[model samples]
Target: DNIWGAVALHNFIEMLRSFFQPVNVHVTIADGNITLKNDALLEILKA
Candidate 1:
């Protein structure tokens, strides 16, 4: 599906960014849902 493909691309971008970034940015699927979790993202979410 297109949604899954988009998620894959997003995850790939995040993975590449993680190399130069400090925070561990990554994505995964949980219970048929997309889960994007990372310290940088967490902080943004908390703000």
Candidate 2:
């Protein structure tokens, strides 16, 4: 189940990368927290 979860996450990231081409996308999971970084996303949120 953990492996499946990882695979699903990888696929999701790949999908996001394609959708946000030309922008750097990063995802970090630590201490039970998830952090995502992307300038494009920030712009969307600021709008």
Candidate 3:
């Protein structure tokens, strides 16, 4: 059915996104400098 196919497609997209998406992680120093990938930040915001 259409509903089943939509669910399958959504699952596939999520899987692909997870597999291809990169994570943004940071370690701060006393100097207070920040560095991170924008894509990772966007992903976090999407969640």
Kindly give the number of clashing pairs for every candidate: 0, 0, 0
Candidate 2: clashing pairs of residues: none
- The digit string of per-residue lDDT tens for model 1 on 1-47 reads 35575587788778788777756655443433544445455444345
The parts of candidate 2 lying over 4 Å away from their true place are 33-47
Among all candidates shown, the one with the greatest lDDT? 2
Q: Which candidate wins on TM-score?
A: 2
Q: What's model 3's lDDT at 2? A: 45
lDDT of 2 by residue, 1-47 (tens): 24565588789889998988847767754523533356454443345
Better of 1 and 2 by TM-score: 2
lDDT of 3 by residue, 1-47 (tens): 24564477568767767887856433222323333346454344345
Deviation (Å) of 29 in candidate 2: 1.6
Stretches of candidate 3 exceeding 4 Å from the true structure: 22-47
- Estimate the TM-score for candidate 2: 0.51
TM-score for predicted model 1 compared with the true structure:
0.40
Error of 3 at 2 (Å): 0.6
